[model samples]
Target: MSEHIIVRVAGVVEETAHVRTLRLEKLDGAPFTRFRSGAHIDVVGPTGVLRQYSLASSPLESSSITIAVKLEPEGRGGSAAMHEVKVGDHLKIGKPRNLLSIADDADQHLLVAGGIGVTPLLAMAYELYTWGADFELHYFTRSREEMAFAELLSERVEFRDRVHLHVGVPRDQQPEILEGIAGRLTSASHVYTCGPVGFMDQVRAVLAPTVGDDHVHIEHFEAAEIDTSGDSTFTVELDTGESYEVPADKSILAVLEENGIEVFKSCEEGVCGSCVSGLLEGTAEHRDNCLTESDRADQIALCVSRAASDRLVIELY
Candidate 1:
């Protein structure tokens, strides 16, 4: 089930050429829920599109919640709709939920933010600063004009020294720059990165050679790419004894929703863990990046994962 609260856009600030910061407050004039540094909320826009955004506001501030958006013309129109919103316009947003956090035992934190992915890490940096924890933020943008919150962050006495800017130029020389940045991480440092798939993959590959896998944490700015040419039809057996034939072109989530089974999902590309269902029987050809070997009960992400067997049984109840 989806829970929503009504919020009014209190103000909007153009952080950069392409990014805008939306400051929101409860319509009731009451304090909003407290959220962790890396938490995100789902916004149901005026266009009837539901999209998730990482909170960029400090958790210590209860007056309002804020999110930064980068205008992506080719995206599903959520950002464009958000850009259209003006102060005083009301919006329905979900309560904050956290899927990322800092480790208490880490001696140092390395936050790497690429392009618009700086939203969550900005909040993390605030918390780290508040706690007086040792950390550094590497902010990457195509150019100085494209750096979100550059002035706001750079002017802050607390963030000025810790935030490093890495501007992009001559676009053809990214691989070398990315490699040098990724190679700086140390064993005692816990790394958190949010960026493009290729950016994260490059970081992981570089870290894998020396750093422990557990020390490197990442979140996807977009879904990872995968091939679907081999997809075939399959049967899904529900606990109620009813069955549904999922066509190769349709996802299990889509077939179930068409059959009146409401599944709560976000990031339909399967990067988010919202639609992961426990499996009672049958192996899943898991194609999602959210699941790991530690995931219990042979769970599967219905959005992308398909049946390894001809028929699969699921426990959705």
Candidate 2:
């Protein structure tokens, strides 16, 4: 069951110049349930502006959920409102929902985090630390001051030793440090990356040769906006032999929702993988930022992506 609970901010920890961690406690006698490592919660702000933030705290801790927010100077009032939230002020929040998660069969894990993308990766790292799994975090940022959880992460000697911070310029220019972690890249490793578009692109380019295609996992906070300039209408065939017409201006997801098809979605810009559907036939003109090329052949993100062919068949799971 889903409950829109009013949660009060217990405390705030300023992790960096632009980042602050908010600790929340449910006030309506709702039980604080444990979530997966990469889970996120949607916060309803003062003006009812909804925004999602990844949980930074470990899932093992069920007392409260911690989310780190980075104030964006040009953001659309979401970050600014989050910054203004006081200690005693109540905020509406949804239950935790996980889009990215650790695969149980993954032998070795390579985590790449950039800027505030470290939020989700940090929780995953804590889970790996608890399980004593083979994992390494390659954290990249412009400088140490811009990154959050540096002190908290560094305090843990065991996880700190596994984390290699790459500051200043990009990793491509720093060959020595990249070489040190190069040996860890293998087919047995599951490489998970999260960050901005440019940062994720660079990491994908650098490790494409070593990690292969299918083993690399990724999560994005924002997706690149695409130009939907094409023909007006396309046909979508469901597994039940139902067909629907989707307009070029509208996404497949919107068309489905209009028809009362309940598919999960977060980050409508196509960064989150919540709205992914299985492609049965026809080529998909993938405009999403989440899945790789190989993943696109079999899977399609209903949001921000369209059909390349005149007719497409998909199985909605």
Candidate 3:
């Protein structure tokens, strides 16, 4: 029942320095389906790398889908390959999946985006604007030159003044800005954030005292790097009464896939919770940034997390 499909790259637009907007056209005969704001699609590439990029375009326009990718110098081949993609290139894409979605009952929305993390937030801004909903977008970057979609975002009526730009400042200088604007966020207003790990961490630290845990939503383009160097092997038990040994150097998801378990996953770095499953037993050494501490005790993300014990069991739904 997976909605995964292969699509052709229809076009590419240079959005800014080190950033390109990829336009994908569906090959299915049923035409393109709609995705809500804050939804992301996984693109499978060569070398078995599965990367997740948020859809930046509005869902109302279903003829095509767009994702903004920022080239990282130290990144693995994913971003580099995406940057070199040409028209007519075929890519495997998963259906739009959303973990950070806009709440319908929210009275107002506060969106904070950093660098390329602005991709999903931009879609949310569009959704709010189309509905004439109350919202504010705070975008932060190292410099104006690095910001994407400057022209389009600035031209929109709802985003022009409400969009606050923060650039060229030390880390200490950012706290005041975050506290000044985001201090009033309440249960009635949900705060959504996406960006580099440090950026998201700073935002979380600033708002942790003011906003409740349920009111904050975040998405990461890459998984958090964790030190998995250890000497151990764990047993992963599937729901079908099958078990496999996962080496310490590899992830549980990798072992399962090698054994033909066919689990749905994207963003193997653990940023996306697509590989999360119920933990039948054993303590998990949670290294992912996607789930909270409380959530880790009950469920585990097989992509990045490993077991703290010799034997761990998981039930895939």
Candidate 4:
């Protein structure tokens, strides 16, 4: 479990039209924050709702932590609430969890980011540059005006020849550009991508022919949309020989909570992949966006997914 801390919103910088970066520091003036590249902290909102945001600052900074948030009107109000927070306001947040940590001892690294997906990659770029490693960043945005952190990144002493930008007008050339960047994949190289499902899907498709699937990494801010019209009430069998009924109208997470069976959760919208439990038996109706096809075969996220069969046996972590 991550330690929850109270933090003060020290600053907020508007990076683009809809994107803003929040600079947070310890409320008590203690430098206790610690996190790695690609880690994200869960911020507790005014409504007592927790939303996950990736840390956009390098680990080299301990005085404060930085996160970039893009306003999504359709979202669950995390970004909107964050935008409404004034500087010097106090907010509670969870310790960082890193589901997208960088690999070690790679000959070279390739980072492909689309739109606001560049937040995590920004931290990785800084870390890679600090280590004097071989890496390149390819950023895709709708337009120059929509580009976040452009000025900050361009001013970096370490990024003189390490960055490339693409405007999204002619998306027809994206495949070719990605293919050209991928070129011939080497065993010592690794590729990481953070973007929309379609963009990441294309990246995987174009690069998989040359690069091994294991060499390519990805993270999703939102889960892929899945249909649930066929959902029905089902049963869940626990390791302790206990069983519970899950109604079609209620999620597994909700039912478990009703029974006092606690589970860790954040961003209950099914994107964070935090409540994924091991599937022991029965099929799952995968409604989450982050799980891969292969992941779906072995695990189920209790927050959104439910039993596809009459009953499901699972291992809770």
Candidate-wise lDDT, in order: 0.81, 0.81, 0.83, 0.83
RMSDs, each prediction? 2.6, 2.7, 2.4, 2.0
Candidate 3 lDDT by residue in tens digits, 44-68: 7544566888999887778898998
List model 4 lDDT by residue over 41-123, tens digit each: 78887767677888888788888889888898997787788888889999998888776777886788888998989998888
**In candidate 1, what are the lDDT values of residues 1-317, reduced to their tens digit?**
27888899999999877789999999878997678898888888889788888899889899998998888899899889988899999988887876667777777888878888888898889899999999888777888888888887779865799988888733345556645755665677777778777776666666645456777777765777778899999999887788999999999999999999988788787766778888878878887866654563478889988987998888673
**Among all windows of ten consecutive residues in candidate 1, which has the lowest summed lDDT?**
169-178
Would you list the clashing residue pairs of candidate 2? Answer: none
Segments of candidate 3 deviating more than 4 angstroms: 1-3, 27-30, 45-49
- Candidate 3: C-alpha RMSD to true structure equals 2.4
TM-scores for all candidates: the values are 0.89, 0.87, 0.90, 0.92
Model 3 TM-score (2 dp): 0.90
Error of 1 at 241 (Å): 5.9
Off by over 4 Å in 1: 169-185, 238-243
Backbone steric clashes in candidate 4, count? 2
